[model samples]
Target: MSVTGKYGGPLPKGPWAERLHEIFDRLLAAFGPQHWWPGETPFEVCVGAILTQNTNWANVSRAIKNLKEAGLLNPEALFSIPRHVLAEIIRPAGYYNVKSERILTFVAFLMQEFSGDLDAAFSLGLWDLRSRLLSLKGIGPETADSILLYAGGYPIFVVDAYTARILERHGLVGDDVSYDSIQSLFMDNLPSDPALFNEFHALLVALGKGHCRKGRPRCETCPLAGIHLNP
Candidate 1:
């Protein structure tokens, strides 16, 4: 599963770093800065990260709007609300019943650990915070990393399907790479800055949505079309 090359020689870290930065530059030039994790508060961003799983941002927005309109976006309110009621409110997000449980599970963790204070929760060390987040019922690596980088302002890189597709297409990673391996490619190469990680991930999403489609990628006009492949 290594991305070094077919011959198993160690990949030169310097070139990989430079190429990663080049990809980032190209994406930035094409899409400009993308202020990501679109939410009003840190808590809201965490909620959006949870709700956005297996769904579109538009649906997550509607779900968040419903919560806000119903005065239930607060951790206390969400923690105290009935799961059925919550599910009905967030029905537009798809998998309402499951997502409701997931949100409430996170709310419970927030209340129990940090007394519902997001800043307090984020104040913990990165590994400690991420481990605790992963211990939650439905929060996986991507969701936990999203919460960490976007909501907690941590410097962890968040990898998604778009990121894997882009790297694989550019011969930077194996198609069967694990999540941790894909994530390590960025974390090992890029500077550990929250802003850079945020912008890079968002730009990848933009490219994924706009050009690097699943079935038929618009590679002819993609911003990274002419970029040198790692392999």
Candidate 2:
């Protein structure tokens, strides 16, 4: 897509910025804070980000609850547990064996790089920490950004299928664009604020689930119904 610019930085007042603002405002008006990433701690958020790969939140929640009940929710404890046992505990999240290894990988990275302190891992400036996360075995762009934004409160926007569907439907971004390209639409136009990114992403997920669905979109009732549609 022809979205990326030469400077690749936040733009001045323009259509792009205004459109993003309009979307955020309308979505917020329709739905309040989503209280997303329902985790008790940053470590739990990180675990959720990893466990949520290809699964719904309901299943991920069950898996996490199992971990907590077993007293293996912390990184240090999870790291010491047997791989197969960890896999069994998180079986509810699906892809148990693989997710088990991935969670262990992330915990080990934390233990080694930051001595099991999520704050230290989060304190590594956005790009640095994101790069480290993307290097892990199963962590991809969406997963890494979820860890960064939802867990560490980083200022980077997390792009997912829902965000992509909304932007494409509104003609803000073309269909099947690269993740970074779609992400630039917000990160390059909106002010760099973690709170804004967090709530905006959550709002998009809400819209995607409630109205702008994958199979059949209810555009007429969508919060962003007529904002950016080229009529």
Cα-based TM-score, every candidate: 0.93, 0.92
RMSD of 2: 5.0
lDDT of 1 by residue, 84-177 (tens): 9999999999999999999999999999988999999988999999999999999999999999999999989999999999888878888999
Model 2 lDDT tens row, 57-101 = 999999999999999988889879999999999999999999999
Evaluate residue 159 in candidate 1 and report its C-alpha lDDT on the 0 to 100 scale.
92
Residue pairs that clash (backbone atoms under 3 angstroms), model 2: none
Regions of candidate 1 where Cα sits further than 4 Å from its true position: 1-13
Clashing pairs in 1: none
Strongest candidate by lDDT: 1
lDDT, each prediction:
0.89, 0.86
- Candidate 2 global TM-score: 0.92
Model 2 gets an lDDT of 0.86
